[model samples]
Each structure stands twice: as C-alpha cells, then as structure tokens.
Target chain A: MERTRKPQQERAKKTVEAIIEAGFMFISRQSKETLTTTKVADIAGVSVGTLYEYFGNKEEILDAMYARFSEDVTAMLREVTPEVIRKTPDQGILHILQHLREMLSRDNQRYLHCAALLSQNLPEQHVAPIRQVLATLSLQYLSRNPEYINLPNLPVMNYIMTHGGIAALVHQLSSDDPMVTFDELSQGLATMARHMIEGSRRDAEQANP
Target chain B: MERTRKPQQERAKKTVEAIIEAGFMFISRQSKETLTTTKVADIAGVSVGTLYEYFGNKEEILDAMYARFSEDVTAMLREVTPEVIRKTPDQGILHILQHLREMLSRDNQRYLHCAALLSQNLPEQHVAPIRQVLATLSLQYLSRNPEYINLPNLPVMNYIMTHGGIAALVHQLSSDDPMVTFDELSQGLATMARHMIEGSRRDAEQANP
Candidate 1:
C-alpha cells in the first residue's frame, strides 16, 4: 500500500513522530533483522493499523529514518562553513570528526542500520542530494585553501576520500570488536585527510615546477 | 533444501568445479541479485537438478565462491614472508596493494558483494577465520620491522587500519564515479600506511627516549 497521506494535522504529526522515534529506538536496541511492524507499533504504543496508516512497510519506515539521519548529518555539515575552514582547517576537521563520532556513538546499532542502507546501491533520488551537499561543502573548503587548489579533481577526491573514510571508520567504530579506540580512529583519519591534501599539493608543485 | 553431499568421484568433483566457475562468472558479469540457479546451471552446461544436487541455494553458491576467493587472497598473503618484508618494507607494501588492486579490478561487483558480507555482523564462524588469517599476516609483517615493534597494540592496529583502508579503497575504486585513478589511490594508501607506521615509531621513540 502507498504510504498513508502525510500527517498534516497536529495530532497526526505527533503520531508519525512517535512511530519514527519508536522505529529508531527499536533499531538501537536490536538488529534491523529483528524489527517488525507489530513490534514498532507496540513500542510506539500505537495500534498496528495506525502504524500501517503511516508506513507501507518496515522498509518504508527505514527510508523515513534514513532521510531524517541524512538531514541531521547535512545540517551538521552546514556548520562547517567556509569561514570556519578558513580560520582553522585542523579545528574544522576535528569538529566534523567529533560530531560524527558522537552521532555514531549515540546509538551504534542504529548507526549500523543506517550505514547498511547508505552503503547499498541506493536510488539516485535518495543518494544524490546528500552527496551533492557534501561535495559542494568539500569544494567550498578546498577552494578556500590555496594549497589544495592545484590538486587534480579536488572536489571529487575530497568527496570520495572524506566520505569513504568516514563510512569505513563508522563501520569499524560500530562493530562489536572494534579494533581501535574512538580517539585513535578519529585522529588517524584526520591525519590521513591532512596528509592526503598536503601530499597532493606537493605532487602538483613538483609537476608544475 | 539440504545441501548435496560433497562429490566423492573425480567426475562429480569436476561438475562442482564447473558449477562454481559458472557462479563466479555470473557474479562478475552481473549483479548477484540477478543470479539464479537455473541461469548458473545453464551457464555451466549442467541440469538444474545437478546444480541443486551440489548446492542448497544461491547463498550456498555464494559461500563456495567466497571460500575460493578467500583461499586465493590467503595464498597471496602467504607470499608476503618475513624475508620479503625485511628485504624492503616499501616493496612488500606495494606488493600487497598491487595484489589487492588486481583482485578488486578483476571483478569489481563480486568484490563489492564480498565486502558487504564481510563488513556486516556476520556469524563468528564465517568471519573469524578470515580475520584471523589477515591479522596473522599483518602481525607477521609488523613484527618483522623492528621500528613497528614498539607501536601500541601493533597487531590490532595493523588489522584495523589495513582492513579498514583496504575496504574504503575498494569501495571507492569499484564505484561508478570513482574520484581517483587506481594509480593515485594505490599510491595514496601506500603512503598512508608508510606514514602511519613510521609516525608511530617516532612517537614510540620519543616516549621511550
């Protein structure tokens, strides 16, 4: 069934929010594999029929959760403005990393579910906007730094490395048998980002000179 | 359905080999989602019943293919002996990276599938052995280098960094719109590995001295 018409009324909106909250709470407490619509309804203290009224299925509920997550992350990314990057690149990197770490640590199991969904070959509609936002932000940051200006395809490189690196680190951090402490993983990746930028700058200089 | 008994006769063994070869070929040619027993049997020039006689389902076929891939990778890792590592740590690093690049480039789709499976919270029985083998190899390489011996939790560090880095790179490389060329990615990662090892050694020296 198609998703129930968006909850427009105040009461309906509260019901939707409750269901989404309950969905994320369930994800945090258990693996995605164990989640069921009935369980979500019970957790939300709503009728099963009411839950179905909003979400067509569990996957739809996950899609909604994922959209919320993307919005949260994108909002966080917005805080890393050009001014902040220009003032202190290192601090800016740390800020982003710290926020990400906190987000992942908040509910690691839920984060894993989000990771799995994001990592899949999601439709362009679901993926493109977030990637565009990230790429645009990375471009802004790179352009502000003279050293990074000459790096070939700086925008794409920044997007791939930063996004891929973050995804990998998050996956490791969320795993039951994480190898490194959170501090180590974050520091290591920050170091990597710094070095990659510097390394490419060096390469560009040698090639041009 | 229960999996077929292991082939005891030479002819039956050949049939199983043919089926597995067909399975990998299908995976390489198309996404795993599209693979089916009938298609695999057709590709292998075997009856559908014969395919079922050897494998319980599509997942079992994937499991067999994964085992084969693991064996191939483990064999490559075995070649990174103490002598090779001691002779030139840089060369050993490049060797491993080159082998990984080749394996990934050989069948990008299949590699992605394997990565997804391995990255997930797979059963300990399925994950532990592969991880143990990789960790052992990483430990061997790290220990043979005197500078790395003093690094904190060297074995675990090696495992996490190496595995995480490889996974991140593979994901990027296999992507449709890859950010960096294969040469750049391999070089960048090799540089990261070298720096991380040397950087840790420097820290250790500073702390001890």
Candidate 2:
C-alpha cells in the first residue's frame, strides 16, 4: 500500500511541474492570445481533463505560475550577500547589475514577454503578487543598511528605485529599437541607485545635525 | 464663386468635427470594445458611409481624437513659465502635479480609456507618432537647460527619461490599483530629474577640474 501511494504522489508532482512549465512556454512563445487550456495541455503531454484536474482552468494555472515565478525572484533577492550590501554604493550597484544581467540575459525574450503580458492583462487583484515581488526585493535591499532607516520615508524611495527603475528598463527592452543598450541600462540603474543612496545619506546627515 | 466655395468648405469642416466629437462621446460612454463605425455614425446623426468617408475607419477617428488631445497637452507643456522651471525641485514638481491633476481629472475616462486601448490594440506603426510626441516634449525640456548640452551621450539620458518615463507612468496609471498617487508620481519624476541634473553638474565640475 505504501509503495503504491509513493509512486502515485511522485507522478502527481511531476504532472503538476509539467503543466506549469508548459504554461510558461506557451506564454513565452505565443504571447497571451494563445493561452488556452487546450494548448497548454497539448504542450504538457496531458489531457484536457488532466489539466483541468490539476488547475481549475487557464487562469488558475497562470496564477500558480505567477506565484511561483514571484517566489523565485524573492528567493534570488534574499540570496544577496551581506558583504555586497556593506560595500560602497558604487560597488553594491555593480553587484546588483551583474545579477540582473545574468538573469535577464539567460531568458531575455521569455522574461520580457511575460512581463509585457502581465502589464497588459493582469487585473488589480493580480497586481499585489507582482508588487509584493518588488516590495520584498526592496525591503531586503534596505535591511542591509541601518543608516538609511532614519531617512524620510525609506520605503517610498526604495519603491521608486525598484518599481520605477524596472519599469523604465522593461519599456526600453520591449521597444523595437531600444535606445538604452544593455550596458547602459545596467549603468543607468547603478547611477540611480547610487544617487538615491547619496540623497538619503544627505537626509540622514541633516536629521542628525 | 470663391465666397460660395468657402462656406461649403466650412460646412464640411463642421460636419467632420461633429463626427469626431460624437465618436469621442460614444467611446467615453460605451467601452472601447463596443465602439463601431455604425454606432459612431448613429450618434453623430450621419450615415455610416459618411462617417467612413471622413475617417476611413475607427482607428483614423481615434488618431484624429488623439491628435487633438496631444495638441492640448503640448500647448500646456509649452506654456511652462521660466519661473516654474527655475523653482526648487519640490515646488516645480508641485506645479507640474497641479497641471497634471487638472488634465487627468477632466475627462479622466477619455485619456485613461484611450491609453489602455492604444497600448493593447494599436499596431507597431501607430506608436511612432506617440514616440515623437514624447521626443518633442523632452527636446523642449532639454533646450531649457543649456548647461546639459555638453554631457556625454546626453540624448540617451533624455530618451531614457522621456520614453521610459511616459511608458512607466501610463502603465502604472492604467493598473487596477496604481503604486503611486498623482503627487507621489510627479515627485518621483522630479526626484529623477533633480538627480540627473545634480549628476550632470558633478560630472561637469569633475571634468573641468
């Protein structure tokens, strides 16, 4: 009985993984227009019924995929080393840029296309998970710097950097002819981060004085 | 003969204006999904064929309406007083915010709905005019600050801010629950503009030193 149950559970987990992977592939390849349960099931090597059994429908699968992707991003953000945070703003920015370059370069089209679809299609209710992905990454960045705590509205500033910075980068990346090159994008972000740090430092000094 | 023809031409212009105004009203009252040539013609008190005679299609009418809207915005931006630009960052931001509030508040649905429709439905070719709109505004802003001319790769920075800034703002404003309020959004842009100015200043001082 135990051996039969173990095999069944493992098979179920594999099926779910296949479904999620297939959904991501479909979204990346066909954009949002082709995101139907039938196509996903066909891509996953599963029946329509099996797909429905695993996920209520297409939206449910997408929601699960969104949650998983957001969680992965949060996990990556938390993995930033303490030494990286303690470095000067210039050095810290370099490390952050390096990480972003590696991640985005690995799957540029997939990530960029997915982001475009989300920006276009996702409802207000769905925005929170995406925003949380951003807020979590930002909070993690700020956690390493105690000096910035006393600065006026640290979270608002960080939100501007992460959300606004990423928003700008994504728009350029999605454009037919990107004006900002990959290197320039990274450097620009580093510049913004450094300036923001410097501005907060000035605020901190003023508050202390 | 010339005087008689002038009144005829004037009558044609008035008819076209009536069609466009009715089209705008139709889209504002009904959703974009429901907007059609027949419906617009019915509202305009013209035949469907007459509406098509002027517009050729729905997109052409939309383009006309958008062109008018852009002209209004351009006139507003062009009117930015020298004193407004010379003010402190926070105060300058507030000035812009007040203007934005008035523009956005009046017929909020019109701009919001049209923006949503364009980002999703318009083809790649349609984006060029809007991009030009952004470029013109940036050029006007840059020309105001002659000091920024000598910066390395200056056009690239302006492109980032104007193209990326407009894209980010539109996407956020279109979202279900926007991340930034009008005041916050305007201040965020001001902070970025101020930082860019300060960074350029530092670069100049360092270069000359």
Candidate 3:
C-alpha cells in the first residue's frame, strides 16, 4: 500500500506542476475570451476531475503561480550581499542585476505569469506590481541609506529601474541568442546606475559648496 | 462630373482609411484564427470588394499601414534641430526624446502597427527591427561624432537605447494617464544619458592624465 501510494503522490505532484505551467502558457498566448477549467485541463493533459482535485478554479491556479513567484523573488532579494554593495556599489548594482537576470533567465513557463504580469502591468502603470517591488524597495533604500547610493533623481531611477532593468531582463531572457548577454546587460546597467550616482554626488557637492 | 467626382473621391479616401484602421484593430485584438478579408471588411463596415479597391489583400493592407507610418517617422526625424544637439547634448537628448514621445503619444490606431512591432519584436530580441532604427542611428551617431556625448560604453548605450528608449516610449504611450509624462520620461532619460556622459568625461580625464 505504501509503495502504491508513492506512485500516486508522484503523479499528483506532476499534475499540479502541469496545471500551473499551462496557466502561464495560456496567459502568454491569450488565446481565448475566458480561460475555462476545461481549457486549462486540456492544455495540462489532465482530466477536469484531476484539475478539480487540486485547484478550485483558474484564478486559484494563477494565484498559486503568483505565490510561488513572489516567494522566489522575496528569497532572491534576501540574498543580497551587504559587504559587496557597501564597498563598491558599481559592482554591487552589477551583481544584483546579474542575479536578477539569472532568476529571470530560467526561461521556464512557471514565471511566464510574472513576465505576463510585468508586460501587462507596465502598460497600465500599476506602480506597485509584484515584479516592481524590488525596484520600489531599492528606491526606498536609497532614500533611507545615503551611504550605499544617494540619488535625488528618483524619477530617472524609477524609469530606468522599470524600463531598463526589467525590460532588458525580459527581452534578454526570452531569446535564445540575445543581443545582450546577462553579463553584458548587467555591466551596462551597473555603468548606468554608477554614473547616475556620480551625477548625484556632483549635485550634492554643488549644493553644499 | 466635377462636383460629383469630388464627393466620390472623399468617400473613397474615407473607406480606405477605415479599412486600414480596422486592420490594425484586428491585429491588436488577435481574436480570430486567421485575419481574412471578410473579417477586415466587417470591422471596416465595408464589403470585401471595397477593401480590395484600396488594397489587393490583407498583406497589402498591412503594407500600406507600414508605409504610411514609416513616412511619418521619416518626416519627424528630418525635423531635428542640429544646433540644439551641438550646443547642449543633455538638453539635446531630452529634446529629441520628447519629440519622439510626441510622435508616439498620438494614441492613434494609424500607427498601432509600429507599436505592435515595438512590442512583438522586443520579446524575440529582433535587434535590427524598424522600431529600433532610431536607437541604432543614435548609437551610430555617437560612434561617428565625439563632440556630442562620447562614451566608450557602447554596450551599455546599446542596451539602454533599445530597452530604456523604445520600451519606455511604448509603455508610456499605450496608457491613458501614464505614470511618467512625456516630459518626465524625457527628463529621466536625459538625466540617465547625461550622467553617463559625465562619467565618460571623467574616464577621458583619467586616461589623459
């Protein structure tokens, strides 16, 4: 009985994963008027009864995807090295953006929902979207901690963080042979952020002097 | 025949324009399996034969739309003030980006094809797409002329020009009330480019010393 239950458990895990993956693929394609349970199950290659066993509805499946992504982003943000950023922020920004690119570069269908949210929410300018939470937090950190990076040009930072940061990541990660690699992309963004910091420094000096 | 011909010509122009507009709307919505002549005529409130009067087929309809948009963009680019860029490149970049935003901000279905190209081409990382011709030209200009905003970080410039420039414009223009106004977006991008210029100037000084 225990051995038989193990196969059932493995099958159940596979079913849930397939359902979530299908959720992103559907959202990405935007193929239908309304994404019904039957449609999702068909894409997932599972029966409607099996889908019902796991998820009550389509929204719950999407919510699960969101939850998984949010947790991953939260964990990623938590892993930032203070020493690296404090010592040399140019490299720090580079490291952070590279880290971002890595997480995005997974190229898995799971986070297609996040990319979908990112692409969708950006046009709507939903400033507090989950994906932008990192950029938003970075801005807050800049305001709080002058030692790391003191930037008065929050608007510019805000623009680049969303457009330059996320757009580059998404575009680069989506393609097989990208125009800019993650390393090059990271270095370039670091250059961008680092230079902006220099400009801010000049501004501070000009005001005080 | 002269008075009768005038009204007939005006109506003909109107019909052609409607068909083009409907073509963009259908492409934008992507609701159907195949974009047939019948579907386009339905959207245009005309018969399929009427659409054929303006164009041969769906491809011709899209091509006409592309041609019109390309000409408009060409005209806009030709109106650039050389003196403005030569004198104050920071302001020059701001002015140019503002000009670009104005052209994009029309919110007309007429140029929705270009916006669609901008959005669709970005994901696949089509480096030399028509939408990026402006950014590409900007980089080429930088390489050719050191007098105006010279920077050795071509990689960074290329990355930001496409992602920062085009993606920001498309996103900002698509929305009704964008978070970053044309002024704000242009100002932010100018700040971004200007700071990098300052950083480059420092690099030049250090290298010379």
Clashes of 2: 0
TM-score, model 1 to reference: 0.73
Better of 1 and 3 by DockQ: 3
Which of candidates 1 and 2 is the stronger one according to DockQ? Answer: 1
* Range of the 10 consecutive residues with the lowest summed lDDT in candidate 1 chain A: A116-125
Better of 2 and 3 by TM-score: 2
**Evaluated with lDDT, which candidate comes out highest?**
1
Question: Which regions of candidate 1 are displaced past 4 Å?
Answer: A1-19, A34-58, A80-88, A105-134, A147-164, A194-209, B1-5, B9-58, B80-89, B104-134, B151-160, B197-209
- Model 3 misplacement above 4 A: A1-14, A22-43, A48-71, A78-88, A105-131, A147-150, B1-16, B23-40, B48-71, B78-87, B105-132, B147-150, B175-177
Interface RMSD of each: 5.2, 3.5, 3.4
Ranking by TM-score: 1, 2, 3
The DockQ of predicted model 1 stands at 0.19
lDDT of 1 at B39: 95
The residue-by-residue lDDT of candidate 3 on B162-206, one tens digit each, is: 566766766666555567776777777777777777887787778
Top-DockQ structure, candidate number: 3
lDDT of 2 at A18: 90
lDDT of 2 by residue, B1-209 (tens): 22122214777778788887886788666756688888888888888777766676677787777666666655555565454557664466457556755775576556665555544444434444555755665555457756666775466556556555555566566666666665676676677666666776676788897
Write one digit per residue (lDDT tens) for candidate 3, span A56-153: 66557766666666566556665774433353557766766666656754666445434645443233223335446666556555555667454576
Candidate 1 per-residue lDDT over residues A57-128, each given as its tens digit: 777887788777777667767865654567555466667778766665565446555554444323334544
Error (Å) of candidate 2 at residue A7 is 13
